[model samples]
Target: MTARPPLWRDLRVIRAAAQVAALVAVGLLLYVLWFNLTNNLRRLGITTGFDFLDLPSGVNVADNPISPGAPLRRTLLVGIKNTFALVVVGIPLLTVIGVLVGVARLSTNWLVAKAAAIYVETLRNIPPLLVIFFVFFAVILQLPPPRTPLVFGGLVVSNLRITVPWVETGPGADLYGWALVGGLLVAGGVAWWRTRVYERTGRPHHRVLWAISILGVVAVAGWFLLDGPIRPSLPVVDGQRVSGGFSGLGAYYAMLSALVLYTASHVAEIVRGSILAVPKGQTEAALALALSPFQRLRHVILPQAMRIAIPPIISQYLNYTKNTSLGIAVGYAEITLIVFQAIGNGRPAPQSILLLMGAYLVFSLTISALVNYLNRRLRYVTN
Candidate 1:
C-alpha cells in the first residue's frame, strides 16, 4: 500500500487547524469588544460590579411590598418570584385552552371548527404587545373601581385588583405540608403499581382514579388529624382596598391574560399540526375497535401527537416567558421591569442588563432541559 500522507499534510490535520484558527479569531474579537466596553464605561464614571446588589432598592414593587431599605438582591428575588408565578399559572391554562381549540378545529361540526380557526388566526396574527395593551386598557381598566368592586361569592373584582378565596395555613401547617408530600409519594407509588399490573395482566388500568383516591383519602385524614392545618379565606373589601385571600394586581391579570391568549393561539396551531401528522390508520384502528371519539383521541391519537408537539411547545413556553418582559409596558413588576427601574434610579445599566439577560437565559435553559427530558422519555423505542 502507498505510504500514508504525512500528519502535517493530512486533511484531518488541516480541518483541525482551521477550527482552532476560527476559535482563536472569535475569542480575539470578543476580547476587543470587552476591552472597549470596559474602557467606555470607565470614562463615563460608571461602576462595573455586582456590589450594587447589596445596596437598597428604594423603588416600590406593585402587589409585592419590599421595605424601602431592602437590598437590591431582595428586590430581584421578588421580581423572579413574580415571573415564576406567571409561568406556573399560565402554562397549565394555556395547555388546556390550546388543546381544546386545536381539537375543536378538527371537529366535524362546521361552526366549532370555523370558530377555532378564526380564534387561532385572529390572535396569532396580532402583535403580542398589542394584545397586552388591549387587555390592560380595554378589558382590565374598564372594570369598576375598588369602591364599587364586583363581588361574587368569595371573589372580588375591580379595575384596581382582583381577589379570590384561598386556603389559609394555620398552626401545624408545616407538619401537614410534609404529610401531604408523603401522601403524594404514596399516591405515585400506587399509580406505578397499577401501571405495572396493567402491563402484566393486560387489564384496564384505572391508575388515575387510584392515584386520586389515595391522595384524597390521605389529604382528608391529614386535615382532621393535624387539627385543621388549613382553612379557606375569602376576599373581604376593606374600605378602598381588598384584604384577605389571594389578591392579584390588575397589571398581573392583564399580562397573564394577554400572554395566555396569544401563546395559546400558537400552541393551538402546533397541536393541530401534530395531530394531523399522526398516522390516519391509527384512528381507523381505534374506530374498528369500537372506541368512542373521546376514547380514540385519548388512547390512540393524543399520546402520539404529544410526542411530536412537545418540541415546538417548548419554544412557545420560552416565548411566553420572554414576552413577560413586555409587562413593563403595562407597569407589571416582572424582572425586566424591576431591572429597568433600578437602572433609572442610578444603578449601573450594564450590570443590571447583564443580570437581566442571565435571569432569562436561566429560565429558557431550565424549560428546555425539562422538555427535552420529557421528549426523551416519550420518544419511540424502535428496534
Candidate 2:
C-alpha cells in the first residue's frame, strides 16, 4: 500500500475530526446555556435545586389529603404511581383490543372486516385530546353522582369515581410475588419441554393447555403456602372516605379509556400492515396443507406477523407512555400534572420540569428496553 496521506487531506482523519468537533461544539453550547440559566435565576433571587422536594405542598389531591406540614416528596411519588398505574393497565387492555380488531379487519366475512375498518378509521382520525375530552365530559361525567353510585358485581361506578376489587398484598406479598414469577418460569419450561416432546415423538403438543394448567397449579399452591397473601379488596365507602379496594377518579377512567381506544386504533393499523407484509405464499402454503382458516392464521400467519409487528409496536408503547402527560388536562394527577402543580405552588420550574422529563425518559427507555428484548428473542434466525 502507498504511504498514508497527511491528517489534513485523509478522508478517515477528516471524518473523525469533524465528529469530535461537532461533539465539543454541542457540549460547549449546552454548558453556556446552563451557565446563562443559572446566572439569570440567581440574579432574580430564584433557587434551582431539588430542595423544593422537601417543601410543604399545601394542596390536597383527590380525596387524599396531605398534612399541611407534609413534604412534597410523598405527593410526587403518588403522581408517579398514578402515571405507572395508567401504563400498566392501559397497555394490556389496548393490546388485546388492537389484536382482535386488527385480525377482524382481515376476516373473510364482510361485516366483520367493515366494522373493524370503521372503528380504526373513526378513532385514528380523531385527535386524542378530543377523544379524552369526550370521554371525560360526555361519558364519565355523565354517570350518576357518587351519592347515587351504581353497585353491581362488586364494582362501584359513579361520576366521582370508579371502584373495583383489587388485590391487597399482605406480609408475605414479596415472597408470594417471587413465587408467581417462579410459577410462570416453571410453566414456560413445561411448555418448552412439551414442544420438544412433540417434535421428537410427533404427539399432539397442547402446550398452551399444559402451560395454563401448570401455572394455575403453581399459583394455587403458592397461595396456600403463603396463606393467601393476596386478598380481594372490595371498596367499603364510608361517606367521603373509601377503603379496601382500588378507587380511580372519574378523570382517571376517562384518561385510560380515551387513550386505550385511541391508541388501539393505531395499533390495529400497525397489526394489519404487519400481517399484510407476510408473504402471500406462506398463507397459500398453509391453505395447501388443508388447514382451516383459524388453524392457518393461528399456527402459520400470526407467529410471523408478530415478529414484524413487535418492532413498530414498541413505538406505540412509547407513544402511549408519553401521552399519559395529557392526563393533566382532566385533573388526573400524573407526573406532569403534579410537577406543574409543584411549580404553581412556588417550586423551581426548571428543576421540577427536569424531574418531569426524567420520569418520562425512564418510562420510555424501560418500555423500549423490554420490547427490544422481546424483539431480539423473536427475531428470525437461519442456519
Q: After superposition, which runs of candidate 1 have C-alpha atoms over 4 Å from their true positions?
A: 6-9, 194-207
Lowest summed-lDDT stretch of 10 residues in model 1?
59-68
The digit string of per-residue lDDT tens for model 1 on 1-383 reads 98879988998999999999999999999999999989999999999778999999987888776886999999999999999889989998998999899999999999999999999999999999999999999999999998899999999999889999998889989999998899999999989999999999999889999999989998899999989999999988888888788999999999999999999999999999999999999999999999999999999999999999999999999999999999899988999989999999999999999999999999999989998998998899998
Q: What is the lDDT of residue 42 in candidate 2?
A: 94
Please give the clash total of every predicted structure, in order: 0, 0
Error of 1 at 151 (Å): 1.4
| Winning model by TM-score | 1
TM-score of 1: 0.95
Q: Who wins the lDDT comparison? A: 1
lDDT of 2 at 102: 96
Give the clashing residue pairs of candidate 1, or none.
Answer: none
Worst 10 residues of 2 by lDDT: 61-70
